[model samples]
Target: MTYALVRPARLDLNSYARATGLHPEAVRRLVALGLLEPVRDARGELCFSPAQVAVAARIQRLHHGLSINYAAIGLVIDLLDRIEELEADLRRLSERH
Candidate 1:
């Protein structure tokens, strides 16, 4: 099995909230809503992957720019995840051919 060697730098929840300008409650809500996937650190604090910042940013845009509600955001995020998976599958199949 192949593995990705490049592990992204991790950011603590506080830093993530600060960098994204999102309140801690918002971050917690995102995590609780299954929008953000966070890992626990050694100290048992919430930590997020760097990639999650981009996802959060997109969600922020949808929420603020388009005034999208959480339910709609969930749907959009699900659709986007499916699209990414499909695109990756297509790329792999094309490479095989």
Candidate 2:
């Protein structure tokens, strides 16, 4: 079987911010806080995957809904991701029986 590798389109900081409906500075702050992961382009500019738009929205919802600081947001995101992974593992284990 031949598998094709698909690369996602990358967006510059401004585009990412616009897509996420956030200010560029807010996106930068998220990058600084390690909430968003971006790649450096050939010109040393930050680029984000289009998929991150959803993540940014989730972050905004969590921040505003819970009224939590960015640091706490990071922790919450981590826990949510861990729970997702555990749930997937549980599903796989059950499927094996």
Candidate 3:
């Protein structure tokens, strides 16, 4: 089987902030808090995945809409990730049976 490789577009800090409608400092804080993961490109500048824009947008809604603190937001995100993992596992197990 041939595998198809798909690469996500990477966004620089300013572009990411613009796309997310968040301030640069807010993105920096998210990176500092380990909520966002940015990797260095060939130029050694920090860049984020396009997919992370959606994640940041979700966090923005949770922070502004629900007034949730960053720590709680982290926990909430983690729980949601766990739920998705469990659901995927359930689906796989059902398919195997």
lDDT of 2 at 19: 94
lDDT of 2 by residue, 1-97 (tens): 8675976699999899889999999999999999999999999999998788889988999999999898789999999999999999999999999
Residue pairs with backbone overlap in model 1: none
Which runs of model 3 end up more than 4 angstroms from their true locations?
A: 1-8
Q: What lDDT tens digits, residue by residue, belong to model 3 across residues 15-67?
A: 99999998999899999888999998889877999999998988988988999
Per-model TM values vs. the true structure: 0.73, 0.86, 0.80
Question: What lDDT would each prediction earn against the true structure?
Answer: 0.89, 0.92, 0.91
Off by over 4 Å in 1: 1-8, 84-97
Regions of model 2 farther than 4 Å from truth: 1-8
Please give the distance, in angstroms, between residue 95's alpha carbon in candidate 1 and its true position after superposition. 9.6
At residue 37, give the lDDT of candidate 2.
92
Give residue 58's error in model 1 in angstroms.
0.6
lDDT per residue (tens digit) for residues 1-97 in model 1: 9898986689998899988889988999999988889999889999998888998999988888989997689898788889999999999999999
Q: Write out the backbone clash pairs for model 2.
A: none
